[model samples]
Target: MEKFAMKKTLIALAALAATTAFAQSTATISGSINVGIMNTGASGAQTEVASLGGGANAININVAEDLGGGLRGGFDSQIRFNAANGDRNSAGAVNALFHTANTYLTGGFGTARIGSIVEAGTCAFDPWGCTGGAALQAGTGISALGGAASVKQAVQYTTPTVNGFSANYTSSLSARTNERQTLGVNYANGPLALTAINIKGSGNSTTDGGTAITDTATSQRAIGASYDFGVARLSFLNTVNKGVGGATTADFTSIGATVPMGAYTLLAGFNKNDRATANFDTKISVGVNYALSKRTTLGADLFRSEELAAIAPRTGTAGSGFVTRIRHTF
Candidate 1:
């Protein structure tokens, strides 16, 4: 079943590509290579080797066409490779098959995308929307929890801008038999922007034996905004998730800032997560980047996280780490 699904997705992407090429008769290829090394200095920490002696890399290709009536369609894909072991980051093969990550159509009404990609909630709440760059939390964060990356079968739609405001909706259809939906509204004017998203998931709860036990429902609300002030930009994000029965509820909040000076930029951020059990965690990070040229940069980052639990003081420990990386665009 999974193979068939993948095949169908590929066919759709191929059709989209063909249409784009025929309509515009133009093609352009571009991507980036990022290499980084991470190191840790804490008690009992292992002296793991640092550097691109072993690293990961990503490549992407995009094709689009301009249609009449101000409409356009495109196909996008990406592949991640483990330069150390010469293996692909995805499942199945050494060099994973090129998967259509973003195949969509756009017009004056906005855009709609398909394939394995982020739901609308993340797009609305993330500081970086569809712009693929190091500024994205998923691309630069040291901890997975700091970035929410989920791939599911989804359909999304955005509305045309009205007075600098627009709305979006996304629905997920998966065999897990769960249905997830998200709605968001965005406003952008001058150097200020704001977005809010509400998400809900519903399905049948299963027991250990896989038997349906009860109806399960989950909901989340997130809001994020940023303001640019000439030399700096400040951003904040807040989210709350609610679950019933034996499920857990969670709340998260984050604040960050970026300042640019000449060819160098500074970034700092703080985030907190609280669970239903009252256990919480906090993370703080600071990073700096120096532009090597128009299309290249070198950066250094440091991050630390601490657990805060009343009953498990011993389980709570602080971790600090750093990474040095180089990014190049072609």
Candidate 2:
């Protein structure tokens, strides 16, 4: 009789403890590995498969804790690696073990994150994320400006969506020469999303054994929009960069489209940069993607880039090449 009473008491205590929990926590691991061979430069090209962040190879660690009442805290860290050799990325290149790590908090109002965040102003009108061979970056005529691969030691905030409208702001705490402060506003309604952004930064050449000097400020203003029509989506982007030293005023434009057909996707985009004192260039790329599964993709692309006589890097350089790629995620 005494043992029976003790067992009942232990069960009651266990049930009470279960009902009094104040928070919940979760951790998830997700990553992708992309392998491809392509000629990304204008010179001699080689077919190598070890491209980290060249297209899509990344690992992400996400952890979150629910603090109840629609508030949560989390941390996110994404690292880039080469699939061929397993080397990590640093300084946008595969060198170290980690790349970007940040923390975030979400509440009824919105979500905010800091530490190595992505640039917010460059993807307003890109269908292919403004990257890869079939995106704006593959085009020569478009000189994309004021987009950081990732911001370090930064503080960022985003407002909750209200009727498909949201706002975002980011400022870097790093006291570098070209630290950026960015502001962006976004609106999404059904298949249409629009964006407006402003970027301001100041930097000058350092002299006398890394001594700081003053230089003119660089500013960028941009607006872009995209619409999806089920079968295909169209995108347009434009930007103006001012105070770029010798170039002075530079203007850029890009337009692209993506079409979905069963398990395949068609990608196309064009980019151009126009600066009076500099050389003119234009880039065009077309690609196709085959989705093997929800987390696996296979694709190929062909790019044709042209440059004028004045520029040293691409001057009188015109070439076309192809790349085949595969991506798998877990």
Candidate 3:
């Protein structure tokens, strides 16, 4: 009798625990992996073709608890790993190392997290899909100006939206150490959306051995917008960065459109990057994605970039590449 009662008690406790967990307002686990093969070709005598492997993987866990009185708090973390080489790289190092990648937090006025996190300027445009790609430094552009491969230590906050408008701000604590401050505002209504971000970095003055003083201070401003036209969506983005110390300034402008047909979507974009003074570089990409199922997609993209200049002669510079990928979500 005693043993049977003990077994029943344990079962009851397990059921209660499950009930408590389900009663919580929030908790979730999500992840995705994308793998693909790429063929690349460059101008001039450069190898015309080569096969390469590429992929991105990410896993995220989020938990939230209600604090009562219309206040709630939560924590979110993500681990991004490269399955190809079993390498983990980000703000933290091996496992989202840097302070901005894997963050822990608690809050009420909103929420605060410590670890690898994007600046407010980068996050403000999340809903409009401006938050990804090489242009956004989350992916895509190889030399994307914003985040790219750099990480920042920051504190950020987002204000509660009022009338379809929201704003955010992020500030860095350390000066001259990738320290950046940003402000952004977003508005969305019906089929139209707009986002604007401004970023400023404190110039670093320290250099190895002090042979020459280097100014690292720079500023960037960008605006992006998109409109849905039933069968297709049209988007435009423009960014300008002013370098310190008479260095060449850079500007990037992009325009693109996406059209949906049946189970496939076609996308095309043209971008121009003005390095120094004139239009020195330009890129064009076209992509098609076919949904094989609700959670699986097959896609291919072709991209080309060219350098136009007299001194460099644009030799050994122009390049073309194609990528075929399979992506699955779980």
Candidate number with greatest TM-score: 2
Residue 120 lDDT, candidate 2, scale 0-100: 66
- Candidate order (TM-score): 2, 3, 1
| Residue-level lDDT tens digits of model 1 in 236-267 | 88767677553546577767788889999897
Clash count of each predicted structure: 0, 7, 17
- Give the TM-score comparing model 2 with the true structure, all chains together: 0.81
Cα lDDT tens digits for candidate 2, 209-244: 111212346777777889999999998777777775
* Ten contiguous residues with the weakest lDDT in model 3: 204-213
Which residue pairs in model 2 clash with each other? 140-283, 141-272, 141-273, 141-281, 141-282, 142-271, 142-272
With a 3 Å backbone cut-off (N, CA, C), the pairs that clash in candidate 1 are none
TM-score of each: 0.71, 0.81, 0.73
lDDT of 3 by residue, 1-330 (tens): 999999999999999887676457677888666666654434332322211221135667777776545555666665555544545533332233322343433343555555445554332222112322212223243222342222345567777667788877776665454466677788888888788888776532212211111225777787878888989888777777777753547677767777889899887777777763343467677788799998888777776655412235534355666667766778
- Model 3 — TM-score against the truth? 0.73
